[model samples]
Target: MIRARVGARDAMRILTEVARANGQIFEALGVSKSSVSRKAASDQFLSRSESERILGLAKLIGQVQSMTNDAEADAPAWLATWMAEPVPALGGERPINLIGTMEGQTVVSNMLGHVLRGGFA
Candidate 1:
């Protein structure tokens, strides 16, 4: 079963893919094991900012896949461009954290969804 909700689940799935492509997102995002565990618990609610962080990481991860598909694609260079682009902060209103945990099983479910659906777009 999916650990996160629809959007969050997809975000996490892409995040994992990015990790496979470039490096660990936890390390890149300065996310500690504890934070990951907390997020994976499915019982803890993540703040909107935290969720945005995950989304941002997921988008970057998606870009990695896109770059990999093109031989001439420069992932790092494109990553710089992505970072330079303006991104509006989403889920910033109120406390948008959910009271659910994202576990390994959930991640797997999300991954399966991506695999079945041709990856995140």
Candidate 2:
């Protein structure tokens, strides 16, 4: 399910909040901290690739929230744990290690969907 289009500013804000909540740095998302800060402070929109990254991350986070069905306060930690651990369906690769590229993000998203539907991963 797609959500409404998020503006660049909102994307950056969401990314920052998710990263902080997950105890991760911006670099984990293949973006520099300075760039995130600059984008957050400016009115300029993100480039196409960057926008995709933001949207992908948001999607994965949303999936994690849904799968865990945890309280909002614990969602981030649950997501962080899921991302950091190795997955059997991923050939034991940590989800975080694959999130740097679009293909990897798609794979992870699909894997999450499979798990959500009660399949083993």
| lDDT of candidates 1 onward, in order | 0.43, 0.72
Question: Pairs clashing in candidate 2?
Answer: none
If scored against the real structure, what TM-score would every candidate get? 0.36, 0.75
lDDT of 2 by residue, 1-121 (tens): 1234445577667776667655553566677666656766776566666777778887787787777776654555556667787899899998888877899899988987887678998
- Distance from true position, residue 65, model 1, in Å? 5.9
Model 1 residue runs over 4 Å out of place are 1-12, 62-121
Expressed as tens digits, the lDDT of each residue in 1-121 for candidate 1 is: 1234324344455555445444444454444546555565665544554565665544444545563576666554444333333333312211112102243223333433454356631
Going through the candidates in order, what is the number of backbone clashes in each?
8, 0
| Model 2 poorest 10 in a row by lDDT | 1-10
